[model samples]
Target: MKLKTLILAITFLATFNLFAQNTYVFLGSYNRDKTAEAIQVYQLDTLKGKLSKVTSAKDIINPSYLTLSPNGKYLYACTDTKTPNAGSVSSFEFNPENKSLTFLNKQSSGGENPVYVSIHKSGKWLVNANYTEGSVSVHPLLENGKIDSLAQNFQYMDGSTNKERQTRSHVHSAVFSPQNDYLFLPDLGVDKIRCYQFDENKKQPLVETKSPFTKTDLEAGPRHFTFHPNQKFGYCIEEMAGAISVYQYENGTLNKIQRIYTHPDKIKSGFESSDIHISPDGKFLYATNRGKENNIAIFSIDENGLLKNIGYQSTLGKHPRIFAIDESGKFLIATNVLTGNVVVFKRDQKTGMLKKTENKVKMENVSCVQIKRI
Candidate 1:
């Protein structure tokens, strides 16, 4: 009887180990005006937070922005033609068994230069930011996970104070609040962060108490903003000034608390900011500086949610447009748009610093990185 019990215990342990080891990473790519280039898919191992290529050079248009469904069974990407005139988004059915993606369908984004895409928390709405048209649009997701025609669209009229880049309102990113109660849209052209209350029951969004939303410093040109996991603080990456502004947020209103330059003192040069992300632990914040300076600015968040400069790390490539921390917070992947390389970095959890890793993924004009678990 003792021998039989030992064998059954061993079998149960093996099954438990197998069930605990399931996870993956999905990468989205842009074609960069070339044919025969397809969206690349990679399998991310959860145990080590390492990425391995699963699908090579398959044909999918510009997969600019990628977001997974709340249920983790689907992936969606914004496919732009790379021209000012053509833009669309596509949905894919993700297969965990094969580590592959199957295209579902495509829908027009209702404006030119659709650069960013996001899904509502309720999984009922998909929002797009039309850069050239300076507008934001909402699409209803059908029961099958495909996007329908535009349900609502809004265009900004007041242009930015800066003429070169902000001659018109450029809607850059739209994101839903963690509670699914409000939607925040950051516009580069008008230098405004618009807030809207989303009614999941009615399938519509209403402007919040602030309505047209809050404005940053004139001509600050907010490109991206990220809310702290606690939802008490927010950070905005300003493209025009290459600075980050910290804000105290409560009940859908943002009160500016501090602003600081991403670049170190005496390094006076032109640089554009791309993305901002808060660490999973809510203890650190990171913002990417593209253009002349290709580095990431790091900051530490105090108990009060104020930001203090930690340091900066070179991405080891050009145009670090987007980057993401692995689900485990063990690794970070920075996409270099100009150099066409994705540089991997290991995270120092204690000091919130990133050290270059030996693993690097090479591709052409890579725009963004998204990771998931199977």
Candidate 2:
């Protein structure tokens, strides 16, 4: 009887341990022509929703955007540069035991100034957005989590209404549909979201009937977008207008449903928007506003996929370039580019609001933040 009781107690403790394990945050930096910038890592307590630093920030070149594999074992970042067109994607193996990263390999992004990276659902392909060269490329990923080679490349030729902002097409982000059957490329320069049918076996993207993608006003300058878990709705953050657009997505096609301002209707400030994200629970959407006004605008999504503005929270730092929510949906980390600080926010699941936490990590010209669990 004593041995049986001891075994039952051990089982209970093991179950609790699994439940208590939380996610870790990984931050990407821009470096901004400096020598090199570091990618910061932190562990977030799941039960308490608290953040603590893990590895000392390690320096790397301009890593603007980052993505983790489905298994959460590998991390990929886009290093943006102009000299020698040094645009590449670097891979790292994540060591969850120590909350550290081990460098794996690097691959050319196939264009200049690659700003964003997205991995396919199957973990077999990577899609990159080339900001300067105005193109998108798909690359095959090896089993070892390294980029094998470029599989497909598509260039944009058209320009948008805004001359200064859109002198030429600038592909800002490339994302795959939840089903992984289509790829969506948002071009800030052309104000359009280009769609391509993806072939996993062929490792290539072919234009679909819903091809050439959908346009977002002539010069709205869509920067980043996110889809709801239901896969029926999507949201886009417009950079030039500081607006959020809601769309209805069906059968590989998109139709604009609604558009709303990111800022208060009365506040007149010259601010540009940067990133947009949807909560894992599909209850809220958050967007970052930069420039003279720095804050994150929050919105509640209705059952019908409409967005109703909740409020805006000051990022507590400058140039909130990009931010991300942890896998558990317990914490949000906002990266301030100019001031070089990453601030943590406790997400109120009930209210769908963000409260600034006491923990803030300092770094240089931080561009993106990603979080994963062990």
Q: Which whole-number lDDT from 0 to 100 does residue 20 have in model 2?
A: 62
Model 1 over residues 145-193: C-alpha lDDT tens digits? 8888877888777787787888888888887777877878888888889
Instruction: Give per-residue lDDT, candidate 1, residue 340.
Output: 86
Going through the candidates in the order shown, the clash numbers are: 4, 1
Residue 200 of model 1, lDDT score: 69
What does each candidate score in C-alpha RMSD? 3.4, 2.9
Model 2, stretches more than 4 Å misplaced? 1-17, 32-37, 56-59, 82-84, 205-207
> How many clashes in candidate 2?
1
TM-score of 2: 0.92
Worst 10 residues of 2 by lDDT: 203-212
